[model samples]
Target: MARWSNWSGRQRSKPVAVQFVRSESDAAAIVRTANSAGRTVRVAGAGHSHSPLVVTDGVIIDTSGLAGVISTDAQQRRAWMWAGTRIHALGRALHDAGLGLVNQGDIDRQAIGGAIATGTHGTGASLRNLSAAVVGARIVLASGDVIECDRNRYPELLEVARLNLGSIGIVTRLQLELRDAYRLREQAWQAAFEDIAPQLESLARATRHFEFFWYPQTDMAHAKAIDETNAEPVYPLAAEGERCAYSYEVLPNDRPHLHTEMEYSVPAAHGLSCLDAIRTLIRRDFPDVRWPVEYRTLAADDVWLSTAYQRDTVTISVHQDIAEDETPYFRACEEIFLNYDGRPHWGKVNYLERETLAKIHPRWQDWWQARERIDPRGTFLNDYLRRIRPR
Candidate 1:
């Protein structure tokens, strides 16, 4: 068994033992061994999480070796990929097969299982979290029993398991819903903070996806609009503006000033007003501030626990330099965020505890109940999971 820890190095918890289960039988055997010994077990993937969900003093199953895509059903609009599959590799495979993920997060290094477990997502008014795209999954329960989960089988568990946070069991296989691959046309521009607010709603409606970034302490902002369109003929650029759509030289690789970020998803109807108020509060009240304020949008979906469950949303992601303590800044932002009925992303840093988060997520209690059923002993649980969904 290989050992691992999360990205931030904030909290470290090691397992009592570790094992690499290459197959279903191997996973089953490992579970049986743990059950017999009366020990808890958890699955560890990319470990990109900032939270301590993967931390455990018990048995840990490393799924890195369980790699490969099992099958694809074009007619069914689905493909079965192994749990260890990383987003970058999976995207390439899907693209080669003329299918692509419905959407993807900014970072592509996370494995499928972990992403689904934590509900990783990207921004777009028409997109939902990655977990929402899961049609089925093969999970290994604590009892060493394996089962297929979907709307038809284990219907109740299926809903919660999509974003199970690894509480239910180790997800070994995933059946994803994909669409025909398409190219995205992206446009970038700068705008004033006040000016952006009025056009936000219109811009989001006009584009397939829209994102904005504001430099804190300054009124300057940058916005990007991406739209899906017919494949354009591959042509050489006239030797001026970097020559091509996918050319790396055309993209800026420069890193921006680092900052402590706190992002929140607010209902789309409050998009302009919320952004406006936040900008005003930060600029007028906190003049010494200097960080980027970013925003993105996504369409509503059926994922019960998704931030965009039944409402189109605008995500306001604010960044503050690492040198600055974010307490006061985030405190100010939280007032506006909460006033707009915002839901913070699970993976990002935030201060809201479980009780308050529960109100924003109406299904929090139900999902917590289902999580308890699968991990009654808190085998796969961690401090963050406990905080958000305490048993």
Candidate 2:
């Protein structure tokens, strides 16, 4: 047996065997063998997810061997990439092809498939989550069969595959709808929490990307805005206050600190109130919570399991240093979020179960039906998946 842990070191697993797969056939064979023996299988990517989504005692298929860009089509603005490609690597490859990812989160260490699988996203009023950019995918099923799905082929399956929780199958390749390479000008500064609270909506709509980090116990928040520009790239270390750089350079930052995070998305209408409530709770009840609270927004998408599904959303993320116990703080925040009818980010920490999730996601039943059709034996399910999305 081999031990595995996520990037945050919060979730761990011991699998009977760890197999590094380089192709679709390898993944399919592992799944088929595991299924035949009545055992479950889990695919481990970069392990960036804080959730126990990858924890399994069966066979573990490590997808790192499948990394890299497979092909690109400039005419259609599409790029086919192996599932294990890291977001940072994908960005560089796309830049070389005169294209770039439509959007990406601040941390670029996540594997491409894992990022989209959990509905990972960046902030912008008009921008959707990364899963929304997935136009096609090739999933290897437990029966040793590979299925290629897209809007034009197996469209219903494509919808489910877009943001699958890795329940349907092992996604070997993804065809992302890309955009022409672009440059962005970013401005970062500090602002009083009260001063920025009321203007969140306007700021989100006006900027290409807008996000903020509120330092607990302080009245100030670090706000950042990134907008497209035609100007020359500005040195990232320039002290002129504003920096203009390629999309990839400006979008991601060096996250030297390690922490565990819990994020939830509430309807756009309840965003402000929820944020205010969280701020008050932290200031009054959990003064010891030192990690910053992150705030961002996302446009609605049709992906059934997406946090922003069918409704524009405001995302709030609470983080705690890896050395501290996050349970109490996260539990309190989860209560406030649930009051606002928030949906938890799949990859992040959450306490929701199937009944609660079913209430928030209208398409929950439909998504389960699709999963049943694709993975009848539940070969991809782990304890975490079974709890949140019971069959």
Candidate 3:
């Protein structure tokens, strides 16, 4: 089978010709196939990432066939999903059953397997990233063995697997904690960028899902509020088969176009100042360029490496039309995030190396150690792991 390693059809790296592996047993068979052939192996879900997380020259195990909703334990508020299930499918299925994930990122096309591996998150003042909801997982080791791990069974491995970044092993299944079905009343509007800093924190506290976007060189900002309340709620439930109109489409309907974006999570305390700094720099240096700045809020989570690990966060996402030169603006924003100890979302573009990533993550050492024990030969690693834990 032909396996192409690419992201969103934008950037593509080397091809790791691969075949679909349907189940844990099928994954084991693929491992045996690669091992016997003396070829390295890697596993990828929907290939939604912008990074080279799965750029391998050897066998690539396609896990989409390993799809299913194993079960849901309402009492425990947990659900078991196969690794390759897409986020949209999972969300719709769960919603139909009167259940929903605690939080979900804007795009639902990413596979659950890939989302958790890369620390993908949705905006919310009270919701954590998807990975943090993972209570346990079924990972296939390099030795062709299936191992079920959790905080108790393999506590060490569980710590690593929580945000493993596809470095440790091939995750075949995931056990996630679920929340009661909820509705999000979305309010989209424009606001002045200067006025957002002081009010950002208070606004997050008032809403459940709040995200906004800022454009470079512009003082204008676009914000969305997805709050929960029994009061008169607007924006009725999205109809079946209707796709969510993303920020880009929602704003400037006549001039919809692709855009480049970068997102970061700052400590709830540092949020205001972070936004202030960006505005100050933009207003002072690049006042001519204009795009709306987007912000979103998410609740705290318990995962060791989650963005909202211990503190609440306000995610400020900046975007520029794809046709525009975004490198300079993105570079400037990266510097701001670095100064504020910002944690970049894994699926998005970030220039963080292992040394830098280690500083932001206290569990980095523990995760790498466990990964070594699980995949000593680095069977599941790609260029991304090399960046995170260079040889």
Top-scoring candidate (lDDT): 2
Q: Model 2, which residues run further than 4 Å from truth?
A: 235-242
Cα error, candidate 3, residue 339 (Å): 0.9
**Runs in model 3 with CA error above 4 Å?**
1-5, 229-259, 283-291, 320-326
Instruction: Please report, as a residue range, the 10-residue window in candidate 3 with the lowest summed lDDT.
Output: 246-255
Query: Per-residue lDDT of 1-391 in model 2, one digit per residue for the tens?
Result: 7999999788889999889999998888888889999989888889989888899998878999889999999999999999999888988789999998878998798999999999999999899999999999999988989999999998988988898888888999999999999998888999999898888889988999999999987879899999999999877445323768888877887776889999999998898899899999998899998889999999999999999999999999999999998999999999999999999999999988899999999899999988888888789988888877754
Cα lDDT tens digits, model 3, 1-391, are 3547454444455544677888888888778777777777777888877667777777777888988788887777788899999876786566555567877777776789999987888776667787888889998877788999987898877777778778777899999988766654456777777676567777777876666777655556677766554443234434322214322112112223455567788887787788778777777776765776556676777676776767777777766655677778878988998898888877666777888888887666766777788887777777667667834
lDDT against true structure, model 2: 0.89
TM-score of every prediction relative to native: 0.86, 0.97, 0.87
Evaluated at residue 5, the lDDT of candidate 2 is 90
Best by TM-score: 2
The lDDT values for all models are 0.74, 0.89, 0.72
Candidate 3 or 2, higher TM-score = 2
lDDT string for model 1 (1-391, tens) is 4456665444356677878889988998888888788777767777766556677777878888888778887666689999888776776577667777777765666788888887777667777878889989888888878999888998777887787777788888998998876666566788777787778778888876577788875677778776675646245632322223321212212333444567788988887788888888987788787777778887777676777778888888776665667778888988889999998766656788878888898778788888778768766665666677743
